[model samples]
Target: MPVPGFADRWRIEPVGAMRVPGVVFASAALLPQVAEEEALRQVANVATLPGIVEASFAMPDVHWGYGFPIGGVAATDVEDGGIVSPGGVGFDISCGVRLLAAPVTLGEVGAALRRLMDRLGVTIPRGLGSGGVWHLPDAGALRKVLEGGARAAAQAGLGTEADLRRCEDGGVLVGADAAQVGERALARGLHQVGSLGSGNHFLEVQVVEKVDDPTTAAAFGLSASQVCVMIHCGSRGLGHQICSDHVRLMRDAMARYAITVPDAQLACVPVRSPEGRSYLAAMAAAANYGRANRQALTVTTRAAFAEALGTSAGSLQLVYDVSHNLAKLEHHDIGGSERLLCVHRKGATRALPPGHPDLPDDLRPFGQPVLVPGSMGTASYVLTGVVPGEAFASACHGAGRTMSRHAALRHVRGAELCRRLEASGIAVRASSLRGLAEEAPEAYKDIYEVVATCERAGLARRVARLRPIGVVKG
Candidate 1:
């Protein structure tokens, strides 16, 4: 079938055996960038895959990526010989966002904001190969984290049980076979559990400035005067190594299975194949490690806040934790029939609507909390999921990068950007000046616009808006 026409900025065409047509959402303002990017081509390639049920979709933030676009979504029928692509999961497996609410208000911390920022900068390690506060775990302990996620951390007395309830999949993925993980992957992950890895990763202290949906905001434990912390990281080198190892394995398997794709990066095998099952198991293990990593960071962050503010750690509570880069087994209604499918979300968040069974009991009435982190020195948003939307109940993960690190460094000056952010009341800390320039606010799209689009498109509804008070980046 020919793609339904819309605007000149986007062109979509159906491929063989696609149950649904492909959709590309872009604007005239972004046409040149989209045209030059490989993301659109990847979208077409994804549509050619076996068992792809609905449309292969790309958001306005779409950019060139390994196999699918950075902002891509695809759902495959698991029972119909569907395939799982390592490229779909990306290198940073379970790379996600975690948000925390503080008992104190912004006014209470205003006078000490600078001091706190400095103290946090000194306490937290950031940058390449930065070691964390946790001792490296042995193989046995590492397996526990790979299988138990934040629940394991809670059992170790790192966080409260409530934290697990607020995290997606309760901070764990079932069927994780740690035995399938390599020794090197285990070693790299053990010590890096609580560390914030470099490249667009950060921890920010923010103040809730606006509440768009009062009922939903209340359900999420967020209020206009409340302060929150957002952490963005992944499974570190462990996840990267898993992806690398499987991509090579899958490339060979693809050829052996007589599968051909437009891009080598899109290498994949049938979901029922031996190689596919193994990759899923290892991926789940790495994803669990990522949840535990965030939980560990939360423990450290709570301690830091308590000591700095002369309060108790119990005063800090988890709001939500969501994974953006992942593939999950879910049931979604299609053509009036409910069927199980594997949904691949790369740079996209799972936004389950209100009353969704997967949500915690307390939060089910409001909907799933979606954390959309902006680039450094900008505002981030807290949104709630809604039903009957495009892209299989998913939304953009962040204010997607509009420029590359190299491009940003060439065009932006680090010192000048720092001064500008400081002038706006945001304290900035970094290990490298060049790194700072690479994550400059100008390097990303306007987050407000992105969130607004999500709302208008019915993917998610805005609950609260937050502006940065302090930022620590790697």
Candidate 2:
């Protein structure tokens, strides 16, 4: 039986071949919901993985997901038999959120809100099979995007260097290997840039509602009632294919490597193994694809906002672009010794603390921006990363789903929900009513409570709260 209530976080002692303890971060109110779900079991299952160093950790928004919990985080020493799993990263590689602040106030765009949503809905391709928004000129151009990510997009005049610097890894993984990208994946992702893929993905126009830390908010170029655009997407079909292809390889070759897991979905190979090296290179490429995809969408969004509001494109300044599903080689101090490890965050976001070398010069005094999106038509929070004391510098990705998509459909109708949103002063545009119904806000945990728990857990501190004025779902 699970422990009663959440106490900062609960600890699961190693049992049945477990390599480490399982730790869950939640509040008393959230513990019962978490305990009733299968995510806790998944958390424990992760503890049995190869060379796991720290505890297998889950954030407050944890829910049952593929192999690992939705908000799972783990690190294994690369020099000590660490391995990388496609399951640990998820199918939508580098799925992340980008926040861009518009110089205009919400009051300024109040009357034009409906028109703006209409324009964005028409101009931005979304839903399944959505593509051709990035204008890839040739196969060579596709390779460049897969390799350089948003940096390449900026070079092509989509954004500026300032925007690139504000992004994680400068919006590019410099080590991406295009050669490792499979042809099928290439074909699938060639033109999908600037598209919002289906299921929980969205493009929203928001207004900053409240600021918890005015100093940090100002640094992020945010003010109360300021308009902003938030984009949630990933590498699309290409990342999915890469994960599928690599998972098959690792699963089949596990016996040869003398590796076995409680679950086949946790398939992995050593970080330095030929297969692992190949996956890393390929994963980096897919992640780059995700970065490039979001960057392209940023370009489209800027144009759409500018055209609708009669403001210059430069008025919409990028706040941050951060990836979630990724396994990166990083250095973390473990037991008085700094060691290099492969950190896997499946449905989590990096919350780099202040003074971290990875942060840009301007943001160094503060910390990394952590965008935690809520359910559709709900409130989202912008947080500043703290020291990342015990959670491996990670935080919850979103208001994790409490009910499944099927469950959501039974609870609400998409058309009715849209009407309610509009009545509540929010605009809704979606390609699929079914998709919209599946993403109903009631299907997920209360974001305000989740964020409150995260703040209490010392993972990150809230900076600003944003409420959606208009939303476009895929």
Candidate 3:
């Protein structure tokens, strides 16, 4: 078959034993951006993996990454000798986004914005090696968190069962094995729960400006003029360590299996292999830690909002939580056959269509809520998964970065950026001025464009738009 074409920006061709053609999603304007070639090359590289059932795909935000491109998505059949690559999951296991709708409105908190930002800045740890209020847990308790996920956090008084119901996978993935995790990984994660780590991670207070889908908005308990909180974070050092540990292990296993690929970073073992199973187990454990971490942050956020607004936690409700990183066990139809497959999503959000059994019952009518956060000074969006020709029911994760942090620092100043944001009525706080420069609004692609593309591509539908009132970064 002639290579599938996607505008002038993408060139897709079949390679190796790929059961389907590769699909690259981008536009003419983005073609030059992808000219670097690594991401598209990685797309082809992914096709060479054993048992890959469908087209190895890349979103418009695709960029060169460790193993898979940052926006890469792939699914493999386990029974057909599929393999799992740690690089496909990325280091930030379960790096996700959470949006909470508050009972208070923007008008109520507009004047106290500075105070709220200050309080959040002081309370939340940021920057490198920053610590939070939570004490490090022992290996035994940590293991429980790895296995039980958000439930473990709620039992420990971090949140309630209701929080889990609003979270993806109920905030836990089965088969997590703490024993497979290393001591160093646990140590790095112990004190990091509830802490907001650096690099594209943030917590922002926002106001709902527009509700595009009234019915879905009502189902998600969101309304125009309502205030909300958006938290973007990940598994922290623990997840990083898990990826590092497995990358090295997989490299060694590759040698034993005599596997050769275009890139060493794509090193992997059969999903049924001892090494692969152990990596998945440890990865799940770290992912659980991430879910627990976000849950803990939710508790803190509720407290802050309650204290700032003189309200109660009972009135603060969670909207939804979804992770963009990490691999999942899912069943999808391939060539008209329903088969169990391991779907790896890096910098890609799960956009399950309506009536999926995995979605929260209340949200089933609305489909899975997809939160796409922009840079601090930009607008975020609330979206829902739509059913069509979904490769794996996935969507874009964020206003994907357009420039490197170092490049951003070279062009922007912290003070100037801060002043511009404040002038626009958005409060800003950060652990470091240098860190602030790295996240300059110009560093990222226009989220508005990204969301539009997602809609045009039939991946998701926009439900609401959010404007930031205050942002806390670390």
Candidate 4:
């Protein structure tokens, strides 16, 4: 099949043992690159898994990854032989984006951008294993974080009950089993909560440069030139440790279950099986850790902003928080019947359309907020979910990485990129210049093109566009 340009989607007809078809959403110009990276092969490989429903889907930002392509979406039937793969959730479980809208504008903070950024830099710790944000005190306190997520963080005086509803799953995944998590995994992340991780993860201070839809902008309390904070982080070492732990368990269990996948990275077990339940429970606990992590960071951030900008932290209200890497058992219409499915969205965001009951009462009328952060010094987007989305109510996460970190570092010096971004009015602060170079804007796909493709593909609808003023990376 020659890649399509104008077609809505390019379908990969099943061959051999694929259980379902493969679909890649990209423009004709992007299709060649997608193929060049062999991301399509990963999509096809995902379709071979047991109990895969409908098709294996990829967003326009699709790129090569371990098991499923980055931006991959796949659902498996629980009633059938549905299985859960660790690769589907990625190593950074619940790695996601949370955006806070502020009443301030660029005019108000533009002068103090450096000071504000400096405060944020000192407030939020960075890099892998660099923990110090919140001292959990002991393992039992850590267990509360794993079990209760942001709500627990709130109870600890981090935020408030008002913040709970603003987060997805009310800042808690109900079924997290902290006991399933090993002490080693706990040790990896117990102290890392609320800190930004290395590579890709960042906290950016931005301004709403454009409001694509006034009604949505109003609903989201966003206006042109209004300042906002975009936080992109995850569960830190805890999630990585959990994923690594279960991949080993599942790899061992697969033989006993008589299951085999096209890729060893795609190691998995049946969702209803004992191993599967254990993994899910542990994953949930890690996810809760992720939520609590972001919440703590949010509170820390609010204080930093207040001290730097001389405003109350309460003024920085949360717009929405959504995880891009996760596996959630959601109900969807399939074959004319509602069935529960383990929807795995790696490097993808959930785009539930307007009227979703899960949406908070304040945001139900507008739709769930889909936060897509672009590359360094690039434009981020705030989108509203579209009803009956094409890809399991999912959308692209970031402008999916276009190159490897090594490739990016080889292409440009971090110091040079930082100078260029600063010259463009974006204040850049990174843990290291070398790390900054690895995340240069050139290392990722065009956010505009990617979001447009998603809109064209009916995955999400744009609401507003965010432009960065200051950035801090880990």
Candidate 5:
């Protein structure tokens, strides 16, 4: 039911073994669709996780997922025997979005848009089984990437200090134990360190079509008509294998720990347990790899822009890079006391408010920049965290999927979609038309509505709106 005074908020009062109630952030228009899915039930199931603090929260873009709903956020008290679940983090660990601000404006790139798109299409390595821009020579090299993340890439001259400063966690996820990463996971990551894997992953060239908050937009280094690059992907096979390996291990170890979850998919173990510690270590490694993957893509994008527009790679400045998946141990005030909690965000972006110590020195006054990618050839948004953020300072990741890829394929043809996008002045380059069809704009919830609902819910404030001019799909 809707929260009494909050139009965008709904609360599912505990009815079963739930330790907390379930809170869903969504507008009246989006609520019906969200409720029709199994996501609401998953939200309830998540509330039952041991030691979970506050309510099990779902973002406005909630959708059905493996265990916890894709747009789920939950924090558990560590000292109170909190548990960590692989399902809570999802398979694509650290799968996130990064935005790069270009020196040129849309007008400046006129007539050269196609050329730029063409250069990026061939240069940006994407799609499943495609080798990345940077290939590790051996397991040792892969280990370095898993440990150092984008910092490792920067050390190799593939990135810069400025780039690291803009990344979450300074580009490297701490507590990563490369030794915990299995051989199979390592093998999968070796040749795919800098690539965008398939299924909704993309490299998009966009222009700031509207500045909702001019002051905030300027602080984020964005202006109307300015060009930008948004890259969306994840840790790829390496992250997948890590999540799979850890889920199996946790499932087997759950019985011994006496942990019982409503669903087998929600298998978890105590935060201090051996299995839990091991999974966090491996998850961190995969998170680092995901960061490194995006960093490498950033390098590739810079080169493509330089070659196509006769500009220097330095012309592009990273606005920010944030992940929507994975879990982290954070300190939050609870009942008048600060406690360490394991915060799990699956398909949700962390939105640190203004004046947050975690923000970069220059961006602290403006708040953390939250990148929200829309479906192919649609409008995306740049949001900033607000004070008193709900759901543990988390917000929606993207315009959440409404139809399954299979359903999307049934409604749209790849070739036809490509023609339509091109006719609408958006350049489209995709490895597979079938894959392209799966990401049709109609297949997603309205991006505008999701962000607006987020704002009403006080999760984040919109800074700018972006319109995609070109896209390279995996």
Candidate 6:
């Protein structure tokens, strides 16, 4: 089948057992880099999944991942023998970004920037092991986090109701069943709530450098020179254990149902099957854990600011909290009829358009805020969904990795990279120099190009640009 380009996207016609076609959103400039990896083939493999609707799609930042490409998006008709794959959601579960806009501006916080970052670095628990802002006293306390997410944390005095109102699914993914979570997963999660895991996760202090759409930016509580905190993390060990367990379960159960897939990593079962329901329930619980983890970090961050700059926690208002991973059951129009579908978005952000009922009342007219974090030391962007959106209203999550950690370590030393970042006036705090080397800015694609492709493809629109002034690396 011939691959053809249309506007900012390319179409790959289905062949063999593919149930649908494949669509990749990218500019000609990005095609070369994207083609350099195995992501395109993965996109084609994803099309062969049972009950897939429309076309398997890849965002501009698409890159090689375990099963589906990291930037992949696909929806399966739930009523039509649709299957849910753990690979589609990745191991992070609800690994996503949260943006908090502070009332202070860069000018007001300039003098104390170093002190504030130092305070945050110490207060924020990070790295591989296990430690967090809030330690659950027992399994019972942990259940509250798994079941209630950030909302439960708010009830425990970690945050406010207003914060939950700004979160996706109100900070708790409905239908989560704590009982579905395994003992090992529970133990791993107990002490890890609110920790920033190693490898690409971070807590950044940024300043709004520019506003592309003044009205929408204002609606999102963002303005030029305003300070913000961007957190990129997930459910930590709990989510990973769940994915590992479910993937193994599904792989073993597929044979009984006589279902075959192109890749074993794409292990799946019918959405209505026993194993399938179990995974979804456990996944939701982990997602809630992820949200609560971020909320705990928010509390610590606010307290750090108060101690450093005398600003109250209330000064930091959540602009939005959205997840980029997980398979969600949502109602969408297909063939002119509303259908329940399992939408899987791995390393991709959901960009719901304006007027969507799911949006908060205050943000309904502006659309959902899509937080796109850039590679360390690079500029991040805030984008909004547009009408007639494609790929189920999804957009790129980050500047996709271009080089592996080993390759990046061979290319640049962590000490040199830290020096360069500090020289540019960006403060650096990392658990280890080697960890910093793995995330050198050169390890990823150009974030500006990726965001431009998303806008050009009409997946989302730019609202504001954020420049990192300080970062806490795990």
Where model 5 places Cα greater than 4 Å from the true spot, the runs are none
Q: List candidate 3 segments past 4 Å from native.
A: 1-11, 15-20
Off by over 4 Å in 4: 1-7
Question: What is the C-alpha lDDT profile of model 5 across 175-240, one tens digit per residue?
Answer: 999999999999888999889999889999999999999998988889999999999999999999
| Global Cα RMSD, each model | 2.3, 1.6, 2.1, 1.5, 0.9, 1.2
Count steric clashes of candidate 2: 0
lDDT of 3 by residue, 1-474 (tens): 223443322446775644556776665566566656577778888878877876887776677777788888898898888888888899999999999998877776767667667767777777788775556457787788889888898888888878889989888889999999998998888878888898789999899999999999989989998989999999999999999999998988887766666678788888888998999999899889888888888888877776666665226688898989988888998879998888989988999998888888899867999899987789999999998536599888887777888899999999889888889999888777788889998987778877877786778899999999888987
Error of 2 at 402 (Å): 0.5
Write model 4 residue lDDT over 385-433, tens digit each, in one string.
Answer: 9978667899989898888899998999988898899999999879999
Give the alpha carbon lDDT tens digit for every residue of 1-474 in model 6: 324444778888889988899999888888888888899999999999988999999999999998899999999999999999999999999999999998899998977999999999998999867499898899999998999999999999999989999999999999899999999999889899889998999999999999999999999999999999999999999999999999999999999878898888899998989999999999999999999999999988888989999966336999999999989999899999999999999999999999999999999999999999999999999999999767888999999999999999999999999999999999999998999999999999999999999998889999999999999998
Across 1-474, the per-residue lDDT of candidate 2 in tens digits comes to 343553467888899988999988888888888989899889988898888997999999999998888899989899998889999999999999999999889998979888789889998889877674888877788999988999999998888998898899998876689898889998898888879888999999999999999999999889999999999999999999999999999999788778888888899988989899999999999999899889888888888888888866336899999999999999999988999989999989999998899999899889999999999899999998997555789998999999989999999999999999999999999998889999999999989889998898888999999999999998
Candidate 1 residues 1-474, lDDT tens each? 223443322447675644456676555555456568677778888887778887887765677887888988898888887889988889999999999999888988877778777777887777987877556557788888898888888898888878988899988899799987888888888788888889888989999999998888888989997878899999999999999899899888887777877778778888888998899999999999889888988887877787777665326789999999999888888889988888899989988888888889999888899999988888899998897655788988998877888899988999998898899989998788888999988888777767776775567888999999998887
CA shift of 282, model 1, Å: 0.6
- lDDT of model 4 at residue 372? 97
Per-candidate TM-score against the hidden true structure: 0.95, 0.98, 0.95, 0.98, 0.99, 0.98
Task: Indicate the residue-level lDDT of 190 in model 6.
Answer: 88
The local lDDT score (0 to 100) that residue 266 gets in candidate 3 is 81
Q: Model 5, 14: alpha-carbon shift in Å?
A: 0.5
